[model samples]
Target: MSSSQQSKLIRVVQIIIDVIFGGLVFASGFLILWIIFTPLILKTSDISITASIPVAIGANDHPQLPVEVVGATGKGIRAAFVSDAQGTLQLETTTWSYIIISNIAKLLTALMLAYIFYLLRTVLRSIRAGSPFAPENAVRIRRLGYLVLLVSFLRPTVEYFAANEILNQLTITSPSILLPSPFKVEMILISLLILIVAQVWSYGLELERDQELTI
Candidate 1:
């Protein structure tokens, strides 16, 4: 494509990405507020818990949890709110640790996403300015890689403890609650790929600088 056409295309895509990013930030912020002020707004001290099943199942049928919620028995319970709850919404001080840890991870995730978005936008703008091999872009990409790797491990570790607390406290019969592993190889692979790209980008920047010096 022509230079002008490429710039326009990049601009359009950047705008679309920004819109999505904005929505994500807003939702993250709102949910965080809800989690914090849950006692006042919901008039109950209900600590929110979101649990997910493994993506792949064993040979046996999906373990069904005996729950009153619709599709929970068959489909299995994904998320359950734990509180001294039945007729009233109440928060237990004992479970406060779970809420705090979970929310800290949430806040980190939001910040990471915002940082990634900023780096991506800056890189795109550099490309539109015909400086795709700029040194700063390499640095940004490296930072992005590090950010992903850091969060991949850190968030999971934070969640492991939080989930452990819940499991130790409550006895979930149908579907058991388990602590998640801290090591995630997939995110490590992704971070390596990003770092590799950054290295290649840095090489290109060096070549560009050499060309300018020769001229």
Candidate 2:
């Protein structure tokens, strides 16, 4: 393709990506707000916890707990246990109020990702304008790389604590422990690569400035 055609194509693709990121940011922000204010908007009594925990059982024994019951303490207890010859157990819960704070951290990570995309879109704009090695573009790229690194470090810590908090609130006996190496190796590598590229771009910008001065 011709240079102009390539630039146009890149611009179109960047625009599409920008729109998608914008939509994601808006959706995440809306969810965060909804989660935060829903309890306040509705009556406390109206808010209820509905959980589903899957239990594996031996074929020889009947489940000790009934599917649904009201305890003597006046609280509703709902449980389901299925017999699995393979002996596998899975537990799932949908307690929005209890997990809202965790969701906020996750949503904030999404917002940070959206911001990275926004920075990338700005760099694309500079590239389309035939100034790919502009000093500002290099700075923007560095910022993007830093944000990615920050999220990589923060996300796992937040999630680990959140999972523990959820388990604690649900009165679960099992412990939720996250590994020490929570950040993905691939993400760390990618962030390092981006930072390297940003440095290279900065060097190219310096050369361009020197050339302009020499001319």
TM-score of candidate 1 to 2 decimals: 0.69
Clashing pairs in 1: 45-91
Q: Residue-wise lDDT of candidate 2 within 131-186, one digit each (tens)?
A: 99888998999998898888887776675555555545554343222222245678
Residue range with the least summed lDDT across 10 consecutive positions in model 2: 82-91
Q: Pick the candidate with the highest TM-score.
A: 2
Candidate 2 — which pairs collide? Answer: none
Candidate 1 lDDT over residue span 57-168, tens digit each: 1123322222344443436657543322112112344344545555665677777777787788889888878889988999999998998888788777765555555556
RMSD of each: 8.4, 11.4
